[model samples]
Each structure stands twice: as C-alpha cells, then as structure tokens.
Target: DQQVKQNSPSLSVQEGRISILNCDYTNSMFDYFLWYKKYPAEGPTFLISISSIKDKNEDGRFTVFLNKSAKHLSLHIVPSQPGDSAVYFCAASAPHTGNQFYFGTGTSLTVIP
Candidate 1:
C-alpha cells in the first residue's frame, strides 16, 4: 500500500533556487520524512541527494539533481514496520559488575529499512 505519496508527478527546479519537496502520508504513524539523501552511490542510485553548501541555502544546491538531470531515474520507496508489539531496551553496567545494571524504558520501535 502506498500510504505515503508525493504531491507532484514531476517537477523541475532552476539552477540556483529552493526545491521544496512535498510528501504526504495517509498513515498518521509516520511523523516525519527524510529529505535530501546524504551521498551518491557508486552507480544506478535511486533517491535525491544533496550535500551541504557554502551559501547555507539548506537545499544544498541539489547536487544529485544537477549531475543526473539529463538521465531519467526511478525512485523506489518501501517502508518497514515491526510485526508485533515488542519493547526494546538498552542496559548499561560496570565493567566487572554484572548485577548492577541500568535499563531504559521499554520503547516500541518501527524499523524503516
């Protein structure tokens, strides 16, 4: 199910301008979406990647967009989630003390792979 969707089918941005990508999701569980991927892959990559710019425009000048604008690429999105209700905890203890440990509160986690 494509719970999360994009606003536009296709968009074109200028060389030096802001590109605001709008993403909408039908499910309320998704609180945020990761925008602007970090780095480019070796080859045949899928996703928009923009690096930090000197001007600090925050759009990062759309590095991947500028480089690969000539070629058409497909973007694949697959959201992952936990199957059952499980609590994940992280505990810490001294080097030699096995019994003396501290545990964090149980938190339900959904993994997006």
Candidate 2:
C-alpha cells in the first residue's frame, strides 16, 4: 500500500491564477511534510513544508498546509505563472524512523499563458 498519494494526475490553470494540489497519507507517524516541484530531466526541488506541529507554512508563491487528524495536506500556488508548470510531489517522513521519505506519485500542473 502507498503511504502517500496524489489523486490528481494533472491540473490546468491560467496564468495569474491560483493552483491547488492535494495529497493524502495513511501513516499517522509522519511528522514532517514537504512539497517538491520537478521539471523534465531534472530532480524535484523543495518548495515548502509544514511540520505536524504547524498547520501551515508559506514561502513566497508557495504554501503548504497540514491536517494531522485528517491525515491530509495540500499545496497552494498563488498567482500561478507559465513557468510554474511542472510535476509537484508530496513527501512525508517520520522522525522516529529516520529520514526515509515516502512520496506521492505527483501532480502535473500546466499553466496556460
């Protein structure tokens, strides 16, 4: 069974709009959550993260939200631009189990100009 999952395979949005990507996890032990954005032929880059202690974390145009009780999380991209188009992945890690990260499949975002 997959610990982390991204239900949406892809999303399309216009430039200057908001793009929302969702993720869910089955493991309750996960304490740290991170969002990564990846481009073709390159590795996924860290975007934002929220610990179980915090409900939300933001960095520039990206924001991550966590709901521990519901075992859910989501990423928000404000004023989405064409350059923001990429594959977004969600990852989770448990402190007690070392730094092993469980990652969601990924959500592809297409920002139309």
Candidate 3:
C-alpha cells in the first residue's frame, strides 16, 4: 500500500483566490508533517510544517492543517499569485525514522493572472 498519496494531481485557480491541496497517509507512526513547493527542475523548498502535537501551522500565504486521527493533511494558500504556480509535495516523517522523509506524488497548482 502507498504510504502517502495526493488524490488530485493538479489544480487551477485565478489570482487572489484560495488554493487548497490535500494529502493522505497510511502510516500511523508519521508524526511530523511538512509542505514543500517546487518549480520545474529545482529542489523543493519548505513552505510550512505542523508537528504531530499541533493541528495547524501557518506562514504568510501558506497554512497547513494536520488531522492525525484521519491520517490526512491539507495545505491552503490564500490570495494565490501567479508566482505560486508550482508543484506542492506533502511529506511526513516518524521520529524513529532517523531523519528520513516520505513525500507524496505532489499537486501541481496553476494560478492564472
């Protein structure tokens, strides 16, 4: 079974709108959740993260909500901009995994100006 999955591979939204990306995990041991944004060939840049102890975390235009009980998490971007068009990956890691991170396939967001 896949440990992590993002059902929607892509999303399109007009500028200044809200863009939401969702992710689901099968591993119950995952305690650290993170969101990363990537452009074309570049490495993903960390956007926001929520620890297992917390249900939500936000940074400027980015917000991440974690539902541990449901093994689900979502990333919300408000007032999306054309520059925000990129692939977003949801990642999770267990403390015992020793710094290893597992990433979902990713959700590509296109913000039209």
Candidate 4:
C-alpha cells in the first residue's frame, strides 16, 4: 500500500491567485513532512516542510499545513505565478527510517497568465 497519496492529479489557477494541493499519508510514524516542486525533467526541489511537532511552516509564497491527527497535509501557494506551475509532491520520513523518504503521487499545478 502506498504510504502517501495525492488525490488530485492536477489543479489550475490564474496568476496571482492561491493554489492549494492536498496530501494524505497512512503512516503515523512519519515525523517529518515536506513538499517538493519539480519541473519536467529536473529533480524535485524542496519547497516547504513541517515537523510532527509543528502544525505549520511557511516560506515566502509557500506554506505547508500539517494535521497529525488526520494524517493529512496541504500546500498552499499564494499569488501563484506562471513560474510556479509544476508537479508538487508530498514526502514524509520517519525517525527510524533514517534519510529514506516516502513520496506521494504528485499534483500538477498549472498557473495561467
């Protein structure tokens, strides 16, 4: 069974709007959660992250919200830009898993001008 899943395959938004992407995980041991953005061929770049101890983390236009009780998380991009268009992935790592990360199926976000 997949530990992480992204229910939405894609989302589209106009520029300068908010883009929301959701993710869910089955593992409760996951202590660290992160969001990564990827281009067509390039590797995914880290976006935002939150620890199990924290409910939220934000960076610039990106924000990540974590709900430990629900085993769910979401990424919100404010003022989404065309350049923000990309595949967004949710990842989690457990303390016992070392550096191993479990990734969710990505959600493709399209930002229209």
Candidate 5:
C-alpha cells in the first residue's frame, strides 16, 4: 500500500506564474517533516522542505506548506521558469522510521517559456 500520493501526475504553468504541487498521505504519524525531491537520472536530491510543526516554509521562489489536519503537503514555485521544469516528489519520514523515507509519486511540472 502506498502511504503517500501526489494529487496530480503533471502540471503546466506559464512563465512567471505560480506552480503548485501537492501530496497526500494516509499515515498520520508522519509528523517529522516533509521534503521535496528532484530526481535526476541517477538519484533524488533535496529541493525544499517544511517542518511538520510549522504551516509554511519558504526558500527563494520555492515554498512548502503543511496542513497537518489534512495530511497534505504542498510545494509552490512562484515565477515558475523553464529551468524549474522537473518531476518533483514528496517524502515523509516518521519518527519511528529513523532515516528511512517514504516517497510519493512525482508530479511533473512544465513551465512554459
């Protein structure tokens, strides 16, 4: 059973617009934090993140928000650019899982120039 799932498989946005990607999880105990993963050809790397204890976290044009009650996580990219086009995945690690992480299916975002 998949614990995490992306709301959309893909999304498109015009340049300079905001692109929002969302993830939902079935597990309520995943209260550590949420991380965005951008996988290259080889492996996934950290993109952005937000703490489970907080509602929002922003870094440059990237922002991540957590809705604890809804078990949802959203990643927002303002002024979406072609360079930002990628498949983004959400990951969550429970306190009991140690360093292990469960990842959701990716949401591919296309930023039109």
Candidate 6:
C-alpha cells in the first residue's frame, strides 16, 4: 500500500494564477505533515508544515491545508510565478520517528509565463 500518494504526476498553471497540488495518505499515525519545493538537481526545501492538531497553515504565498478526517492535504500557491515551476513533494512523519519522513513521488508544477 502506498502510505502517501500524489495522484497527479504533473500540473500546469499560468503565471499570476493559483496553483493547487493535492496529496493523500493512508496512515493515520502520521502526525506531522510537510510540503517541500525542489528545483532541478537540488534537494527539497521545506515550504510549510502543519501538525495533526491543526487544519491549516500559511506562509507568505504558500498555504497548506490538512483534512484529517479524509486523510488528505493540499498545497496552494497564489499568483503562481515562473520561478515556482518545480517539483513539490508532500512528506509526513510521526514524532517518534525522529523526524524521518515518508515522501510522495512528487508533482512537477509548470508555471507558464
């Protein structure tokens, strides 16, 4: 079973529009959720995170919403820019795992100019 899944392997959006990426998880034990943005040949950088206790968290142009009841999460970027074109990975970990995370394969977002 895939504990974490990003159904869409890629997404396309025009610059200045909103971009939304979705993810799903099967494990309820995952208490900490994170979104990471990765550029080519580089490691993922942490974007936003939310604990199981919270439903939504936002940082600047990025926002993450967690729906615990449905075991789903999404990352939203408003006014998407060409610079935002990259792979986004959703990751989760339990506090007991020492922050070791399980990652989704990834979603490549292409922002058109």
The residue pairs that clash in candidate 6, if any, are: none
Q: RMSD in angstroms, candidate 1?
A: 18.2
Model 5 C-alpha lDDT per residue in residues 25-102, reported as the tens digit of each score = 888988755555564674767888776788998999989999999999898899899988888989888888788888
Alpha-carbon runs more than 4 Å astray in model 1: 36-113
User: Clashes in each model (backbone N, CA, C under 3 Å)?
Assistant: 0, 0, 0, 0, 0, 0
Per-residue lDDT tens digits for candidate 2, residues 1-113, read 89999999999999999999999999999999999999999999988889999999988998888988899999999999999999999999997869689999999999999
Which 10 successive residues of model 6 have the least lDDT summed?
Answer: 93-102
Q: List, residue by residue over 30-92, the lDDT tens digit for candidate 1.
A: 222223222223222123422212111122232221112221112222221222112222222
> What does candidate 2 score on TM?
0.97
Indicate the worst ten consecutive residues by lDDT in candidate 5.
33-42
State each model's CA lDDT, in order.
0.29, 0.95, 0.94, 0.95, 0.85, 0.94
lDDT comparison, 2 vs 6, better candidate: 2
lDDT of 6 by residue, 17-63 (tens): 99999999998889999999999999899899999999999999999
Model 2 misplaced regions, further than 4 Å: none
The alpha-carbon lDDT assigned to residue 111 of candidate 1 equals 30
Give the per-residue Cα lDDT of candidate 6 at 81. Answer: 96
TM-score for all models, in order of appearance: 0.32, 0.97, 0.96, 0.97, 0.92, 0.95
List ranges where model 5 is wrong by over 4 Å: 37-40
Candidate 3 lDDT for residue 76? 94
Give the number of colliding residue pairs in candidate 5: 0
Q: Measured by C-alpha RMSD in angstroms, how accurate is candidate 4?
A: 0.8
Worst 10 residues of 4 by lDDT: 91-100
Write out the backbone clash pairs for model 1: none
